[model samples]
Target: MQESVFCMVVSRTRLIQAIACFLSLYKTMDNFKVYILCVDEKCYEFLKKINFDKIVLVTISELNREDLLAIKASRKLNQYCWTLKPGFIKYILTLEESIKRVTYIDSDLFFYQNPNVIFENQPYDSVLLSSGEVFLPMYSKEVNNTIQSLTGNFNSGFISFKKDIDGLSCVNWWDKMCVDSCTSNPEDNKFGDQKYLDDMPFLFNNVYEITTQGVNIGHWNSSKYKFTVLNDTIMVNNNKLIFYHFSGFRIISKYDIRQVHEQDRVNTPFIYQIYRRALEKIINDVEKIDPDFKGYFTVDAVDDN
Candidate 1:
């Protein structure tokens, strides 16, 4: 079996979510390796103790790049994490000559099925990008254009790069762009490392947007699909749900999770329940490793209105 390579960047604030993501992947995928870039020492130490199978833990210091270290003090924590995404993927791709492809996934993404479906029909030399197209038709053209300009036409949460000329060129350009300027300011036509993807198709050949519906089902577009559970399988518009990006979902407490997307509460309550249970179990397991481990719990009041 060909090994699938994946990478993610995580910190203490996203420790629980990252573990949940890994568990979900473990349940679904076979012959895969995940390289986790721990952005903080606490996250690194905690994951070291757990020592999950098929996972290799890395630290920010392992990068050891002068450019990244110089800007560490200037960039915000979130922006700094975003900045590391491309660099981290590039790092992994270089670490192993046998690694044919490397997919970068956000720590908050949970998989329901094998992600090989996303790679079907994709050329080995092509770069795969997740489309950020919001299926809701309620937004006007102006609103849609604004959202595209701000967030870009592609989501950076999940991107696959083949170890070929086109893929290397794309990732290298992205890494350079992010290292130079990865700010959240939209005024400069940059929204972290995400907006830089808008120029990929125009700048490079073999760049394709992933059109698989269930590949990136998330809050931004979940409202547009009719989700149903059949025979223990979650389906989105008759397609098996591959993965769900819990972009803004927050854990207010052990028993309470605040769904930031209003439409998800009404359309995908069952999905949320599954994730809640998974998170609770992950929390229990984490506590076993470190009883005092309290991370990612938010104190914000939930607004039901």
Candidate 2:
């Protein structure tokens, strides 16, 4: 009956992220347990004060051999690896052996409000996939065709899985996909792990699609939803925004765009404002905590934008 959110990020982003997660949790401290699955032991010390049990440290090598083999077998040139994603999935599946249901979250996300309502109202299932079905162009035509051939849809990033049979089926399918991605069709920089989940619904029962913006309101190129702030609450297309995906996050670069040309397009002023605000808040908090926080940006090369 407890709600959970999981995030994976490097140690450098820990300070900025700690502030964001804490700000989001301040309002729902009693309702949700915020878990940051860290790969660095040093980062755990920085997160120690937030909530001990809430912050879990996991080495990246924690992803076992079978999973590693599956990903390596599916590797492509310069493509964002899908194998890393399966590693997280493996971690999530283990939770099923311990708990009922949990929400899997990326570290580069911000929650403007509590999201326990999603778990409270939505029926429990083996897995949850966020359908950008109505949200974007589905990106790659070839990938879409491949997914349709498999009788599934494309999604990653934000997912909810029930700890029962359906979730296991999804995990098993992902295990296979890591080795046999349908879009490994010799097309360079095409579909990576993003669309491979399209096959899960056809393979598993109780596999549901969550259409709410509250869960995954990605602020990247997909602008199916708009952001609005009212009375101090951030709303996505009229619904109060629960979480926002800072999808293009990286350490020094600040934004990480993988394999998409249009992603390099300058972020709209509105979107820039959103990130600037979040980053500003993070800087302020970091300075208050550590005056000598040597976290300011210093670029070796500059973006023309």
Candidate 3:
């Protein structure tokens, strides 16, 4: 049997992103399942209705952790998802034995090529992370590189690990770190849950960075690479565009999408429109199930403050 590979993601306000992420994976990839830890009961109930066979929905009640329960008091609303990542992976591993590997990808990820590019090429007993670089245009060199230099050179958008002694140990260590001090503040070598990933190479054996160029393209590195979509094939620097992390994509309205990719300067890729359309389609479909369903993007909140 093919190795039971899985992908885990968290969705609170960005329910459409998580839905779009799984839809893209199910449509593009051949193997594996995507597990979602809906950050609230509402998100969970909505996902349950869609009932995608390959997608499994998890909730906080299932996790049964006092640690996660305490997060609400200390962490802000947005930081909650980042904090749940490591613990979510640990939860899946414990629930299922056949899952030999798990790749935690951001809910905003949309794919055009097989994710197998990472797993098929992975050597025995190795942990995998994608490099947060390709080549940067001169315009992006200063700020982008400065942050990369400080926060480690890898993007935690997509992380993969094989089931083994070392892999579990690494995930556990990361879980502990996030629970204790995961923050957006990059102080004392901390910047969200991401900076901790900087140590993966020095801390573990057979840790490999992805050679797949199109795996995690976003604004930070997108400025450096050329993206061309020919007859439905999106290529990045002469390789198949595996996945594009639509990190800061915003729905200004149903017809408009604001592409704010991190703090990087980018000549927006055509993939943005394609991804936006997909999310729009999901929102429409989901709203049909429950007309009252409102996404963070769809709702317009007045700034009363």
Clashes of 1: 0
The regions of model 2 sitting more than 4 angstroms off are 1-22, 26-29, 40-53, 61-82, 95-98, 133-153, 179-190, 220-222, 249-274, 284-305
Tens digit per residue, CA lDDT, model 3, 1-305: 33555655554466878878887877887766777888877788777887887877887778888998887678864566778888888887777777788889887788788888677776574578877763556555677667776666788889887778778888888888988887766688887778888887788777788875678987667876788867778898788889988877765445655665443544567777678788789777877888887555533421100
Cα RMSD (Å) between model 3 and the true structure? 3.1
Best by lDDT: 1
lDDT of 2 by residue, 1-305 (tens): 34355544434433564456556656555545544544445455556643445556555556555545444444432122344555565566575445556566655556767766666566665677875443235457676455444433544656666667777667766756655553534243335555566667887888777745566655333456666778987766778877666654433423422212234555432544565566666766656765665532234311211
Clashing pairs in 2: 125-162, 126-162, 126-167, 127-161, 128-160, 152-198, 153-198
Q: What's the residue-level lDDT of 255 in candidate 2?
A: 44
- Report the error of model 1 at residue 234, Å: 1.0
lDDT-superior candidate, 2 or 3: 3
Mark the 10 consecutive residues where model 3 has the least summed lDDT: 296-305
Report lDDT per candidate.
0.82, 0.54, 0.74
Better of 1 and 2 by lDDT: 1
Which lDDT value does model 2 have at 53? 56
